[model samples]
Target: MIYVTGERVQAYQVRSAFFDTRWRGLDPAQVHDYLCRVADEMDRLHRELTTARTESERVRQALRQWQSRHNGCRRRGHDD
Candidate 1:
C-alpha cells in the first residue's frame, strides 16, 4: 500500500503494535478496530489527494493556453 502521509504509517503501526504486558495493555481487538477505521479514513484522503492533483494539472494546462494566446495577441498589438 502506498502511504502518502505519516498518518498512514502510524495506522499500520498501531495495528501491528505490541504492548509489554505487566498486567495487560490495551485490548488488541479494540486496537485493531481503531486501526481499521484509520485505514478507511486514509483511503478517503488518498482519493481526495488524487482528485486535487488531477484538478491542479488541468488548471495549469488551461493557464498555459491562456498565456500563449495572450502573448500572441500582445505581439500583434491587439488589445482584445
Candidate 2:
C-alpha cells in the first residue's frame, strides 16, 4: 500500500503507479491523467531549478574575478 507523498512523487513514480481496482475506487483514467500532469510540472520545476543554480554559479565566479582584480589595483595604487 504505497502512498503518494510529496517527496515520493517523482516523474517516474507518478508514471508507474498502479492502483488496484475496487468496487468504490476512483477512476483510473482520471488518476493517471492527473498524475501525468503532476509529473510534467515536477519536470518543469526541476529544469528551472537546475538553470537557476548554474546561473548563480556563473555570477559568483564573475564576482570573485572582479574582486580579485579590484584588490590587485588597490595594492598597486598604495605602492606609489
lDDT of 2 by residue, 1-80 (tens): 37756655567777788888999999999999998998899899888989999999999999998887787777678532
lDDT of 1 by residue, 1-80 (tens): 34466443644554565545555777767767887887778777878998999999999999999898898788899986
Worst 10 residues of 2 by lDDT: 1-10
- The stretch of ten residues in a row with the least summed lDDT in candidate 1 is 1-10
TM-score of each: 0.70, 0.77
Q: Which of the numbered candidates is closest to the native, going by highest TM-score? A: 2
Evaluate all candidate structures by whole-model CA lDDT and list the values in order.
Answer: 0.74, 0.84
What global local distance difference test value does model 2 have?
Answer: 0.84
Q: Where is model 2 more than 4 Å wrong at Cα?
A: 1-9, 76-80
lDDT of 2 at 46: 84
Considering every candidate listed, which one attains the maximal lDDT?
2
Query: Residue 38 deviation, candidate 2, in Å?
Result: 0.2
